[model samples]
Target chain A: MYGIDSSPIRKAFELARTIENPINLSIGQPHFPCPPNIIDAMAEAAREGKTAYTLTGGIPELKEAMARKFLSENGIKYATPDRILVTSGISSALFLLFNALVNPDDECLVISPYFLMYPSMLKFYGAKVLTVKESFGTDDLNSFRKKKIKLIIFSNPSNPTGKVLSKEQLTALANLAEETGAYLISDEIYELFDYDKKFYSIGKDYDKTITLTGFSKTYNMTGLRLATILAPEEVIKALTTLQQYTVVCAPSVTQWAGIEALKTDMSSYIQDYREKRDFVYESLKDFYPLEKSGGAFYYFLKVPIQDEEFTKLAITSKKLILVPGFIFCENKDHVRLSFATEWDNLKRGMTALQELSKELAN
Target chain B: MYGIDSSPIRKAFELARTIENPINLSIGQPHFPCPPNIIDAMAEAAREGKTAYTLTGGIPELKEAMARKFLSENGIKYATPDRILVTSGISSALFLLFNALVNPDDECLVISPYFLMYPSMLKFYGAKVLTVKESFGTDDLNSFRKKKIKLIIFSNPSNPTGKVLSKEQLTALANLAEETGAYLISDEIYELFDYDKKFYSIGKDYDKTITLTGFSKTYNMTGLRLATILAPEEVIKALTTLQQYTVVCAPSVTQWAGIEALKTDMSSYIQDYREKRDFVYESLKDFYPLEKSGGAFYYFLKVPIQDEEFTKLAITSKKLILVPGFIFCENKDHVRLSFATEWDNLKRGMTALQELSKELAN
Candidate 1:
C-alpha cells in the first residue's frame, strides 16, 4: 500500500516552497484568496465557539446549503439534508465512499488519466481498479460487462486533461450504470471551472451516481478542508457510518465557512479562470500538443521528451515545477502544467515550458 | 457496517439542541472557548490566505512544534519533524495508523471499555478486537502472551472512566510489546485532563509505542480538527502515505492555529476541568456508585437500573442527556456523565441524574 508514489506532487510542492522565485505549476491551487465572506464566516464561527464536533455526517446548515446547491446547479433535488454528507475534502469523500461501497476483491472501474487517489484509496480497501481505455466524458463500458464492476469512480471536468463531460455522455453513463447495476461515482470538483461546455453531473439522472465536489477549487479554499458528497440516501448513510469512525464530521468552523461560501458569488473567479485557460492555451499551443483546457486550470502538455526527464529538467534548469502524467495515467508522454497560480507565476512558468520545449527540439 | 447504531449520542444531541435550556451531557465537548491566542492565530491565518493544502503529513511549522512538544511535555525526544504526523483529529489519526499498521484479521488487544472508535476502526479494517477485561492503568497480559497479538490499543486518562495509566503499567505494556514484537498504541487525547496524576506516555519509554494526542481536548478546540501522532519514523512514513489519500493534510489554517496553540498556557482550562470533575464527584458520589474522578471530565456512574432505560427516562422526563456506559463497554450497569459543560448546566444535569437515580430506586 505504501508502494504507491504519493510523493511526486508533494516533492514538487516542497521543492517549490524552498526555491527562490520558482514558478510552481505543479499544484492546482487557486491564485486568489479564500472569499473574504467565507473566511470571515469561519472567524466568526470560531469566535462564537462553534468548535465542537458536529453530527457525524455534517452540520445541518452546511448540508442544507449543499442540498440547495445540488438542486439549483445540478438539477438534482435532495429534498432534505439526509442525502448529503459533508466531507473533510473531496480526497476524504472519495476515501469514505470507496470504503463504504467497496469490499475485498471488488472490481472497480476507472477511466484512463484518472486521479492518483482513486486507485490508491481503492487499493487500500483491497479492491482492484480495472482501467477502461476510454476518455473521461466518453466512457465505453460494454466490453467490461463480464468484469462486474460494483462501482465506477471517475472525474468530470477531468483533472490534468481539463475535459468536461457532455450532457449526453452523462446520460449514457447514468443509463449504463442503471443497466449494469453498478454505481457511477462522479467527482465534479472542477464543475465551476468549466469554460466551453455546461457542467453535467450524472447524479441528476442516475440515483446510483455519487457526485463529489468541494470548496477547494471553487472558493480557493483547499486548506479549509470542506467537501460535499451527494448520493443516494442509503449510500450517504453508509458513508456516514464509515465517517463516524473516520472524521466524525468536517471541521465545524469550516462547515460554517461553507455555509457562507455557498451564498457568495463566484462569477468573477470563474471568468478569471476562463481567461487564464485561454491565455495558457494560446501561450503553449504552438509548440506543445496541449489540449484545449475546458474546465480545470491544467493542460496535459505532450512533451518533446519523456515526461519524467522533462519534469526534472524543468525543475533543475528552468526552476519550473510540473507533474509527470504517469502519476495521472498509464502514459508518461505528457507533463501536466497548472495555470492556477498567480498571473506572474503562470507567465514565468509558461516561459520555462517554452524554453524546455525549444531546448528539447534542438 | 451501517448496522451499527451510531446515533445514540447524536439522537440525544439532536434532542438537546431542539429543546430550550436542555441540560446536555451527551457529547464530550469542553465547555470553554479555544485559547484566545489560537483563535486569533486561525483568523490571522485566513486573513493571510494560508488556505492552500500543506504537505500531506502537516505544515513544517506545526510538525516542528509537535516535535518540540514531544520532547518538552512528553519527555520523548523526536529530535526531528520526520517522526511526527499532524492529523485531522485523533479520530483520523487512528484511522490512518490502523490502516498503516493493522492487517486483516490481525489479533489486536483492546482494554475493556476502550474508546469506541478503536474497535470500530479496527473492525472496519477487518482486524479482530480482543478485549482484556482490565482497567486502563492495570492490565494482566500474562494470559495473552501466547496469543500472538499484533498490537495493543487503549486510552489513557480514559474518556468514560477517567483512568490514568500508571507508570508501571505503561512500562510493563511497553516491555510486553518489545518482547512479543507487538506494537503499543497509546491514545493520550485526555492527557491534559488528568487531575491528580502526572501523565506518563508509553512512547516516552518504548519506541515501539505510537502515542496519539490532540489539540481538541487540550485546547478546548475540538472543532479545529487537529491532532498529533508521535511514532517511529517508519510508522510515521507509512501513515503519511495513507493520509495523502485520506485527508490530503490537516487543514492548513488549523495547523497555524495549532502552532499558536502549542505555545498558549492551558493551565487555566486544565484547572477549570479539574475543579468541575471535583464538583461532579462531590455532588453525585452519595447517589450513584461513582468512582472518584481522576482525569477527564467524565464519571462512569453506576445506575440503579439498566443504563439505557435510565438514560431514556432522564431525557424524556427531565430534558437531560447522558451516555450509557454500554456505548463504552459491554455492561449496561453504568451511565457516563460529563462535567465538561458550563457549571450551571452541569449542576442541572447532576440534579437531573440524582432525581433519575431516586426514581429508578423506587
Candidate 2:
C-alpha cells in the first residue's frame, strides 16, 4: 500500500488531465535537458558495470564531493562522511525524516501554503500536522514565532509562492527552533535559481536544522533521482538508520553523476533560468495581479478569476496549464506558474493567459 | 533532524564494520553485473534524453511489461495498471506499505529470524512489531495463524536463512490473512534466485497481498535502483500517496532499462548464479555445519562457537567476511554466508573460511 494523497502537485495535474486537453501546470518539475557533464558521467558509470549496491549511506567519493559543494556553495561545515545521507530524492528523505522523528500523534508545525506533501508525509506516520497561517504579504518572522513547533519544514526559496526567506529570517527561525528544541527541515533544492538575492539556509545557524538539497532542479537531473539530507551527527545517524528500510542509497550511477554536477560551472544554467524568470515576471505584469518572485522558477500570480475557474478557462480557451492555489491551501484567487519551460513556450502560455483574462473581464 | 536510527540492517553492518577487517555477511544484495543488455538499455536511455520525471506510478511501458511478466512467468493475473506503484527499490516499497497499512502502535506480524529490516521499518512508523519465532527446522504455520497482525511482512526464500516456504505453507498463511483482514506485504525480491524450487507468492491466494519485487537481485541491477510494489486497487491508491512523500517514482532511465531487462532472456544470468550457489554450497560442506539452502543465494551455516566470537576469530585468523547470525535474532550458533560473488572470489572466500574453522576447532 502506498500513500497517493501525498502528491497534490501530481494529483492536481491528474485531475486537470481528466478535462479535455488541459495545459497542466500543476507539477513543479523543470522542463530542460539535464546538464551534459552529469549525463556523460551517468552513461559512463552504467557502461562500466558500476551496478552493484553501494554503501547504504552513499559512495565515499561522491559524499566527499557533496561535502565540498555544500561548503563552497552554502558556507556550511560538516566533515565526517557520516553527516550526509544520500536519498532517492527529497520525497524519500521527507518520508524517512517523518518516520524517524514524529512519534505517532506527535505534532509538526508547517507554515500555511506549504508544499502539500508535508502534511501527507506527517499524516502517513500519524503525526499531528498543525498549519500556521501567514497572509500573502505577511512578514515570515512574526508568522513563524506564533507557535512552539516540534519540527518546521520550509523551503529557502519557498514553494508555491517563490518567496525566498532572508538570512536574518533564517537565523531567527533557527534560534526559535534551538530555543524550543524543535528541528528545522530547510529545503534548499532551488538554491541556485535565485535571480538577484542569494538564498540562505537555517542549517547555517543551527546544527539541529537538516538541510535537504539535490541536483534535480539545478542540473535538471530529476530522472537521475539523487538528493541528500545534511543534519547533525545524531540526526544523520537516525536518518541513515531509517533510510536502510526505504532506499538503501541513491542510485550509484546518479550519485556519480551528482559528483560531476556539483563540480561543474553552473552559472550559465542560472543565467538561462534568470532570463526565463525575468521574461515571465515582465510579461505577466499586465495580465495578472502578482507578487514579484524572489527566487526559484515560479511566479505566484493572483488571477482575476477564482484560481480553479481561471485554470479551467485557460485550459479550454488557450490550452494553457496553470496550478490553482487551492492545492497549496492558499487563497483561491492565485495560481502557481512555473517558468522552467522554454522561453518560447512561456511566451505562448503567457499570451493565452492574457487572452483568457480579457475574455473573463469582458 | 532526520530519523536515521530506524535502520537495523545498517546498524548491524555498522557494528560489523567496527570489527577490524570483519567479513560481512549481513547485506541482501546480489553480487554481479546487471545483465549487459540492461546496461546497454540504460546507456541508450541516457543517450536518448530519457532524463526527466516519469509518471509517478511509473512509465506506462514498464508497467505493461511487468504485467505481462507476471502473467507469463509467475502465472499471476492483474490488469489494473493503476494498482502498481513503482518505487526506488523494494525498501521504499516496504516503507510505503507500512505507512499505508499500519497506524501508530498498530500491530504488524513478521516471521522471526526473518529479514532484519522489517522490524525496523515497522518500528520506524511506530507500529508494534510482533515476531512469530520459527525454529530452523520446525513449521512456522501455527504461529502465523495466531497473531492479530494488521500487516504481515516476509521475504520469500527468506533473507538470512535462505528458506523457501512451500505452496501449502503460503496458501495456509494467505488464508489466515484473508480471514483476519490482514494485508500481507510479501517481498519476493529474491524470487529469481530460487534454485531448488519455484517461488510461491502469497498473492496467489489473497488479492489483498501486496507483492514487492525488483530487478536489483533478479538481474543484478541493484545500482540501477528499480523496484515496484504490486497491490489491489485500494492498497495501490494508499501506496501511491505514501510514495508521493517518499519517492515519486523509480529512476526513469533505470525504469526504461528495467523494462528491457524483464523482456530480455535472463536464463544465462540465472544459470551463472546457480553455478556460484552450488560451488559455495559444496565447498563449505566439509568445514562448517550448514542447512541446505532451499533457495536464494546464501548458505546459513551453524558454527560450534558463538556467532560474534566465531566471526571475530575468522576475521583475525583469515581475511574472510561472514555475517553473524545473531544480527538476524535467531540461533546464535549460526552465521549467514552470501554466495553471490564471482566464482573465483566465492571459492577463495570459502577456502579461507574453511581454514578458519579448522583453526577455531583446535
Candidate 3:
C-alpha cells in the first residue's frame, strides 16, 4: 500500500477539499502574483524560442548568476560551475541530495517540528528518519554523535517554526558534521524572508554542506517550479547524475525568468512580507503563546486545545483551513498559521480565529 | 564517490563536451525549435500571470486534455482525472513509478538495448535491474517467471534499436505481465515519430500497464519539461504523493501551453519526422546492416569494427560523435546513431561515418 496517504498533512489536505468556502492559510507559497518583470522575461524567453533542454546541470548564465549570488549574498564561495546544480525546485534538489548521501537502513538526522516531506520522503528511500524535537540546540547536535547519520537536514528560517538558525549555531552544526564525516543539508528556500536578522548560510563555511534554496519564495514563482542546490564537486556530481534520470533539468523558460528575478530589485517584496509578519504577530500575540519568527511566512502558535481537535473544530465550525502542528512533529498543543496571503485574507482568517478564541474561553 | 560518473553514457557526454565541432549524430532530441504556436501559448500564460503552483497532479484542464488524448490517441480509457498524472517528463514519471513499486533488492525487468536511464535509475533506487538481452519474444517472457519482478519497463519505438514492438508482440507481453502479476510500463514518447506501422500501446489491453509518454518528441517542447503518466488509481495515488515531495508539480505555464498543444493539429510535425526517418533509413541501409525501424528516430547498425574502437576512431580521426553499442548493452558489434537532426547535419555526420567505414574496411 502507498504509505504517504496516512500522513497527517496528507489527511488534512484530503479533508480540506470537502469543506466549502474554506479560508486556506495552509499553503506554503507567497500569496502575491509573480512580478510582471519576471513574467515578462519568461514570455520573452518563449518569444525568443528558448524552450529546449539546457545542459543537465543548468544553463551557463543561471549557474554563473547563482555562483555570484552565493558569494555576494549568502557569503559562500565556490571555485567553479561544477559546484552548482539548478534543480526543478528546492524539493527536487533535496530529493536528489538525500538519495546521493543516504542508504536504506541508515539513520538520517532531522529536527522536528519539521517540514512534512522530510520524514515521509526519507521513509520512501528506506532510511531511518531520526527526528530530534528541538531547535539548533547543541545537546540535540551532540546527542546524535554515536549514531551513524548519513546527513543532518534542517530548514533555516524554518518551515513551520519560522525559527532562523543563528550564525554561531549553523557553524557549530557544520563543525559537528565535518567532525563526524556526515553531510549537513540545509533548505534555505526562505533565506530571503528573514525579517529581523541577516541570514547566514552554513555552506559558506562548511565543505560537507549542501545548500538547497531557490527563486520560488523570493520571487513568488512557486508555480514556475525552479530552484538550485549548491554543494561540493563530489556531491554535485552525484546530484547531477540523479537529475539526468529524473526531471532532466529545470524548466528552461523559467530559468530565464529566474535570471530576470535575480536582477530585479525585490526589496519591496521582502519589505511587504516583513509588514505581514508584524501584523500577524500583533494580531495573535495576545490570543496564544507565540514566537515572533525572524523569517519565512509561518507562525507556530500553542493552542488551548489539542491541535487536531482544534483543526477539526475550526473546519467544521468556521471553515478555516489550517494544519495541525502534530503533522510537523509530536506536538499536539500547537497549530501552524501561514501569513503568506494578502492582508485582506489574513484579516478574515484571523477574525475567525478570534471568534474561536472567545468561544473556547466561554 | 558519485556512482553515476562511471556509466558509459555519462562518459560519452563528457567526452562530447571536449571535442571541437564534431559531426554530432549522438544527440537524442528533435533539431527543430518548438513550433511558434506552442511558444505563443506559453507566453500568453506568462502574460496572464499563470505562473503559480497547480494541484500536485496538475491543473484540471490539462488533466482533462491528457485523459482525452489517451482515450482518442492511445486507445486507453480512464474514467477520471485521478487516473492521469502530468509529470515533469517521462524520465521523472518513470523515476516516481519505480520508487513507488520497488525497494532495495527488488528485481525489475528491463530489455537490453534499452533507454540509458531505465537501468541506471533503477540502480539508484537500489532496485536490481535484470536486463533481458532479447527483443519482444514470448520465449523470452518466460525467462523472467523464476524471478519475481516488481515491473517490466521498456521503450516502444525502442531507443537504440529503433525496433517498434508489433501489436501481437505487445499484446503477448501485456498478457504475460497480467499472468505474472507484474506491472508493464511502456515509454511511448516516440509514438508520434513512427514512420510505417501504427504504434500500439500495451496500456490499451492491460489494466496494470503504466504508460509513460509525453509532448516532448511530438511537439518539440523538451525544454518545457512536461509529460504524463497514465496508470491505475492505486499507483496514481502513490505516484502523486511521490511527486508532491519531489518536484511539486509540472511547470504551471507550460501545462497551459500543453492544453493548447493538444488542441492543435500536429500532422505536419509527424510528416516531417517521417521523412527524416525515411532519409536516414535509405541512406544507411546499404552502408551497414541496419534495421528499418517503424518508429523513433534512431538507427542501431552493426558496424564493421569493435563498437568502442569504431567510436573512438571516428571521434579522434574524423571528429565525428557517436555512441558505441556496449553503452546500451554489452553488444560490441554495433553503434547507435540518432537521426533527430535536420537532413543537412545528418548528411554531414553520415558522410564522416561513411569515410570511417571505408577506412575500416581497407
Measured by TM-score, the strongest candidate is 1
Q: Give a tens-digit lDDT track for model 2, residues B1-362.
A: 23324443445556666666545555567666677888888878887888888877889888888887777776677745776778888777777677667777887877767777777667757788776654422255556556576987778888877788777767766776776678877889888778876678767667777888888888878877789887898777766655655677789899999888887776776787778777777878898776677677777788888987876676666656677787676468877787776666676777887787787778
Q: What's the TM-score of every candidate structure?
A: 0.95, 0.90, 0.94
Which candidate model has the greater TM-score, 2 or 3? 3
Cα lDDT tens digits, model 1, A1-362, are: 66666657777877887888888888877888888888899999998888888878888888888888888988886546888889999988988887677988988888668777888778778888888743534446566665567888778888878878677767766766676778898999988888876778777767667888888998988988999988878888888888887777898899999989989998888888888889898988897886687887778888878889988899899888889888888888988888887888888888887777788889
Error of 3 at B296 (Å): 0.7
Per-residue lDDT for A20-51 in model 3, tens only? 76787887788777889999899888878788
Segments of candidate 2 deviating more than 4 angstroms: A1-8, A15-27, A77-82, A103-112, A123-147, A205-208, B1-27, B104-109, B124-147, B286-288, B356-362
lDDT (Cα, tens digit) per residue for candidate 3, span B1-362: 24554556556667778888767777777777787888889888877878777788899999888888888987887536788899998888988887788778988888778887787778767888887764657776777776677888888888887788878778877776776788898899888777776678888778678888788877788889899888888888888877988898999999999999888786776787778778777777777887677777788889998999988898889887788887687679988888877777888887887787678778
Span of ten consecutive residues with least summed lDDT in model 2 chain A: A134-143
* Preferred candidate (DockQ higher): 1 or 2: 1
Off by over 4 Å in 1: A133-140, A145-147, B18-20, B133-139, B359-362
Q: What is residue A277's positional error in candidate 1, in angstroms?
A: 2.0
| Candidate maximizing DockQ | 1
Score residue A118 of candidate 2 by CA lDDT.
81
Judged by whole-model lDDT over C-alpha atoms, candidate 3 comes out at: 0.81
Number of the top candidate by lDDT?
Answer: 1
Better candidate number, 1 or 2, judged by TM-score: 1
lDDT score of residue B233 within candidate 1: 87
Candidate 2 whole-model C-alpha lDDT, 0 to 1: 0.75
